[model samples]
Target: MFYAVIPAGGSGTRLWPLSRAGHPKFLHTLTGTSASLLQATVDRLGALADPASTYVVTGVAHVASVARQLPTLPDANILVEPSPRDSCAAIGLAAAIISLREPSALMGSFAADHLVRDTDAFVEAVRAAMGGAEAGLLMTVGITPTHPETGYGYLRCGDAVGDGPVSRVAEFTEKPPYDVAVSYVESGRYFWNASMFIWRVDVFLGELSRQQPELYAGLMRIAQAWDGPERERVLGEVWCTLPKISVDYAVMEGAAAAGLVGTVPGDFGWNDVGDFNTLGDILERDERGNVVIEAGDGPVSKPQVELLDSERTVVVPRSGRLVSAVGVHDLIIVDTPDALLVCPRNRAQDVKKLVDGLKERGTSYI
Candidate 1:
């Protein structure tokens, strides 16, 4: 059986004010759906994997909120990390735990806050990736590049693997300069690295051991105590010691070098929703191209947003008070009870700077 693992660990600082440390972006309903992004991720996983077998690796602070959001997930399946240790550790822990239970189970790791417009295409891509996974190769879903996107990493694919659409990964490239990114798109061999990987738990753990032996050893030790009374104690002692690295750096890159990595191309309207501008792209806009997202599900009343002569603007009002914009063009306005963020839509990625500036101001502001 295929098990889906969602590493729910990012704070999404680029989406700040609306997305806070206490309440991250994945917990918000950014897609205008009744369910939050975390719930949406689980719901998407239900297309291939059973909810009972699905797992979410999130931080200690968000455990209660995650459990509250996904009531159907067993408490045991919600693996709580004492602190944020990045994607590799979060996914590695889940892999180790699943290995102990089902050694040969296939697992797919997907982010919690991404938006996939076409679920059928996503499932088809995942099924294709599973072919590579069953063959014991580290499989990743690569999005067909719609444009020369300098912000995302690129995967240079080689030949097809075993008569399938899946291809052998030639090289994994970091986010390139704009000129180089344009060349990558023109070449057509490059695909955006979505970080959606599928592989057998045993195969993944084996690769982890081959690439990052220390981390693998640490995870195995913790997994040994996972079902026992010493689970908390062992996890607390070992988890923090893990190297703060991404799975791309710690394993996938090395595995690609060793010719064990493969990728399946996918183009189903995927958006990472990293910043307000990208979020605006997926959201419904008015005739003048203004997108307004009202606060919902909170104890507070719906926030009233009034726009006057605003064009191509994105307004997120969470403060319950009426937010009125006058003569603003191509701007992003996000209001919370404690903070207000106003910047040009082009500068949406810099929202993290405001979040960082809050650190010097006070914890209450953050």
Candidate 2:
């Protein structure tokens, strides 16, 4: 059986005002669907894994919201972290807990706030990656790059693994310079790192021990007490102590260097939705190429936005007040109850700067 592990720990600083510390992007429906991103992620996994076998690792603040969103998930399956400790700690702890029950079970970790236009292809890709997992190799899903994207990480594909569709991961590259990104796309051997991982519980724990021994030891202790009365005490004591690092840097990079990592290249129309510009690109646009997203889950109607002579603009109306745009071109305006963000559409990725400025002021908006 395969187990699904979801890491919903990011605040999505780039998507701030809409995504805050108290309410992350995973809980919101950036997509046109009625289901929130987190729910959509779990729903997409239903084709391969059941709700009982799925585990969501989220922060203490959002645990209640996660429960309300996913009622079918057992309370025990919702592993709560006392604080945000990066992806390695969150996903490692989930793997540790699953190892206690079924050491050899194949477990997959996917982010909670990504947009997948084709669920069918995604399921197939995960199934393809499973072969590598069964062979004791760390498996990751790689998206066929359509363009030279300097924002996302890249995974260089090596030789095929055991007559399977999966390829050995030659090297893992972080967000590269523009020139380097162009070369990667021209080579055709590089694929966008989708941050989707599948591996046996035992194999993953073993790799964690080999790469991040301190974190592995802490997770094992917490996992041992997970089902007992000391669950809260042990988690509280150990979770914060684990180093703050991403699984890509702490585990996958080292494993790839050791030739124990494999990837399945797929073109499943994947979008990380990390920034407003990317979100605007995926969402529907108006006649003049304007995208307006209304806040709250309300009936569909004409948006409360009035745009005049606006082209390629993205506006988010959440304050329940009509927003008027005049002579704006390629601009992003996000109106919230407590904060308002206005910047050029090209600067969407820099929205995190506004979030950081607010945080520096000790503002309550974050």
Candidate 3:
């Protein structure tokens, strides 16, 4: 059985106001569909895994909302962290728990805020990765790069493994400069690291134990108490003590060095939706290349929205007020009841700076 673990613990500061601490980016519907990103993630996994087998590891504060969003998944499957520890701890904990449940289980960890336009291709890539996982290899689903993207890390793939599409990971490169990224894309051997992985529970845990023993030990201790009376107590005691690192740094990087990592190249239209610009690109655009997220609920008339001579602009109105834009190009305007943001599309990634400023000013706005 392939169990899916979703790590849903990001503040999404880059998508502030709309994505708040109480309700992060994954909870919103960036896609045209009404279902939220988290819900859509679970929906996509349903093709391969049972709802009961799916687990979501999120922060304690967001537990209630996560549960509310995914009622089909059992409450016990919603693992709650006492505090934020990066992906290593979150995914390791899920691996440890799955290791206890079905010692022979296969599992995959996917982020909660990704957008996939091609569901069939996504599922096929995951199924292909499972073949690599069965052979005791750490498998990552790498996206075939469509452009030279500097925002995401790149993976160097070597010769194909066996007869399958899986390739041996040559190296894991960090996000590079524009020139370097372009060269990588031109080589055609590099892929965008989508952070999607699949491997047998035991295989993953063994590598994790060898590479990140302290973190593995902490997770094992918590898992030992997971179904017992000491579940919360042990988790509270050991979780925060684990090293704060990402799974890429803690396990994947080392596993790649040891020649134990493989990647199945994917071309299933994937987007992380990290900021307003990315979100704008994913949303449906008008003839003038404008994406308008309409305001108001039910059949009630929406507020007046005028976009005159606007091109490639994103307008979101939630303040129940008219939003008029004229001669604006490649701008992002998000208005909520309490907060309003106006920024250029190129500066989308820096929206987090505004949140940091909000923190310095006061926590109330945030």
Best by lDDT: 2
Between the candidate structures 2 and 3, which one is better when assessed by lDDT?
Answer: 2
Model 1 residue 271 lDDT? 91
TM-score versus the correct structure, for each prediction = 0.96, 0.97, 0.96
Candidate 2 structure quality by residue, lDDT tens digits, 1-62: 99999998888899989899999999998887788999999999999999999999998899
Report the lDDT tens digits of candidate 3 across residue range 1-366.
789999998978898878898888888877777778899999999999998899999998899999999999999999998999999999999999999989869999999999988999999999999999999889998988888988788889987899989998988887899999999999998999998989998988999999999999999999999999998889888988999998988998888899888999888889998888987888889898888775223342855578888899988776778889889999999988888899999999899998999899887877
Best by TM-score: 2
Q: Please report, in order, the local distance difference test score of every candidate based on alpha carbons.
A: 0.89, 0.91, 0.89
Off by over 4 Å in 3: 295-300
The residue-by-residue lDDT of candidate 1 on 1-366, one tens digit each, is 888999997888899888878899999988767788889889988989987889999998899999999999998999998988888999999999999899988999999999888889999999999999999999998988988888788999988988879899988887899999999999988999997999998999999998899999999999999999999899989988988889998998898998889999888888998999887778999999999876556444443888999899998887778989899999999888988889999888788887788878887766
Error of model 3, residue 297, in angstroms: 6.7
Candidate 3 minimal-lDDT segment of 10 residues: 295-304
Model 2 misplacement above 4 A: 300-303
TM-score of 2: 0.97
Candidate 1 vs. true structure, TM-score: 0.96
Clash list (residue pairs), candidate 2 = none
